[model samples]
Target: MYGPGDVRVEEVPDPTIDEPTDAVVRVTYASVCGSDLHPYRSMAPSQNGRRMGHEAVGVVEEVGADVTALTVGDTVIVPFSWSDNTCVYCREGFNTSCVHGGFFDGAPSATQAERLRVPQADGTAVVIPEGTDESLMPSLLTLADVYLTGYHAAYTGGVSPGKTVTVIGDGAVGLLTVLAARQVGAERIILMGRHTDRTDLGREFGADDVVPERGEEGIAKVMELTGGDGSHVVVDAVGHLPAYEQAYGVLRPGGTISRVGVPQYEEAPVGMASLFGKNATLTGGPAAQRRYLEAALPQVLAGQIQPGRVFDRRLGLDDIVEAYRLMDSREALKVLIRP
Candidate 1:
């Protein structure tokens, strides 16, 4: 979104499976991501008129002959990045950064399109079990991105039972990070947000406290809720300079900060001062999709996790403009767009 309201549902050629390692998925549910909104707001328009989606859940319409693990009718979650299972990083549990076709190389394109060609099918697509309820699409679809990313944020931050954790954003990923932190057993969840709807869902999903402020003031609230030492872990769900500053500001000395926000231009500077002085750990990236989605699947199937709760509104692909605007304006928490 170079200026605001730049996304449009345009016609593109029907997608086809390009290789034995690829599969064409008929996207059933795709949601607007906070990261997607960055380009629409301040970043420039993509040069390729590219398809704009990274998170989606769909049925395998067609699979390459070599894609033996997935068959037609199998439902799957497409992660933000794609990777070949045999790659070096994949062997190291860093599937998002596989030696071949990593996040940048074979991203495939955004899930906002009607049909998406999933590259590296065996490695990147997490198949949802057969007979999964259709109503779970909104939640299951989230396993592709925000929810999984949230899981990674909490996972990397060392969130666990009895630990006090603070999350740094109220966007869908931030909201899901709260859910992840709670599911992982953070005794106290402090979510940072100014949106009533987001904070409300955070509480429902297990955030013990919500801060309706910004910057240092918000950090103050998180510290207050934690009785002044700050949380044992802080998740910087908002990927920006300000959010990074806030994450550093309120973290207890030595507490870890997990940053998952896509930066302003795919690259941006982050906290270096506090990270070094306090001897705190700061890590950021797209979630380890393959590593976490499998663990998260059963939670959704068992109905223990309602990751779909972040959807404040749902729309058809026809209303892409308004969907972009609502998310860009921060008027909606998460928007689910069906194709």
Candidate 2:
């Protein structure tokens, strides 16, 4: 992205191994994420023609001498963030905060292109099972970011069988949260969203109820659904002031609210009366994708989850600029790009 509202696809040098632990991969599929829209809409200055996109599934074309976990020709999932996986933070399931972790952008390498150079290849990439069908690529690609993030929201929220889980947002991550909730055995999943298209998918993903209302009305509806007790777990997939407040409003006493949405607020109201009285717990941040990729891979491979369906449109890498335009205009849920 060169600046706000500008994305251009131009000829650029192909990626190559830059470190002893780096590897080059041939990207097969890449997708535009909601998070990418943050900078796209921001007034903050950005380097012109910086490579864009963070989610992709590709095959290893080459690996550095020190890389031992993967070899040429292995298919892998490229996560949004790369980490060494041996850092203290990674060992604690916080790979996003790894001391050596960084996003896939600029000179390091980017997934939007036909080729990418992945750092810390052994820890940053998750290899898929051999003989996997090409048709499954879309679903597997989601494991790189959206699915893992949604799963992290549920995982941190303490979702489990019999828990009443409420997901706030109908974006890709929110929709996948519904699926993750079901996988984790959530007995009742409530999805808050207004888009008819997304809501339909939410229902298909196991949402027992849908609340189209927003703010206080939505809060009341959720409280009423729980017999005035509120939900056991709330996943705030929309990171905004009102969304955070709604998540807090509908949380039961001692319940947890997992916020997977990239928060845009600089500050929020979280006083003791609002939290201490209810003992509501607030948790969630950048997902530790590496921790869940392997575990979630089987579900995608088995066809138990299909988050790939969230992509409403598909185009080639050359049309990535239009891909971002579609997502920015809300004309498409998510756009899948093939290189």
Cα lDDT tens digits, model 1, 42-146, are 655565544576778888999998888898999888887888867778777778778765552224455787888888898778888889898888888888888
The TM-scores, one per candidate, come to 0.93, 0.96
On TM-score, the candidate that comes out on top is 2
Worst 10 residues of 2 by lDDT: 43-52
**Worst 10 contiguous positions by lDDT, candidate 1:** 101-110
Instruction: Compose the digit string of candidate 2's lDDT tens values, residues 1-339.
Output: 888888888887888888989999999999999988887898466666567889989999999999999989999999998899999999999998989889885544788999999998999999988899999999999998999899999999999998999999999999999999998899899999999999999999899999999999999999999999999999999888899999989999999999999998979878876667789999999988988988889988999889888988999998988999999998999999998
State the displacement of the C-alpha of residue 146, model 2, in Å, after optimal TM-score superposition. 0.4
Q: Where does candidate 2 stray beyond 4 Å? A: 47-49, 105-107
TM-score of 2: 0.96
Error of 1 at 139 (Å): 0.9
Q: Give candidates' CA RMSD values in order.
A: 2.3, 1.4
Task: Report the error of model 2 at residue 312, Å.
Answer: 1.8
Q: How accurate is candidate 2 locally (lDDT)?
A: 0.91
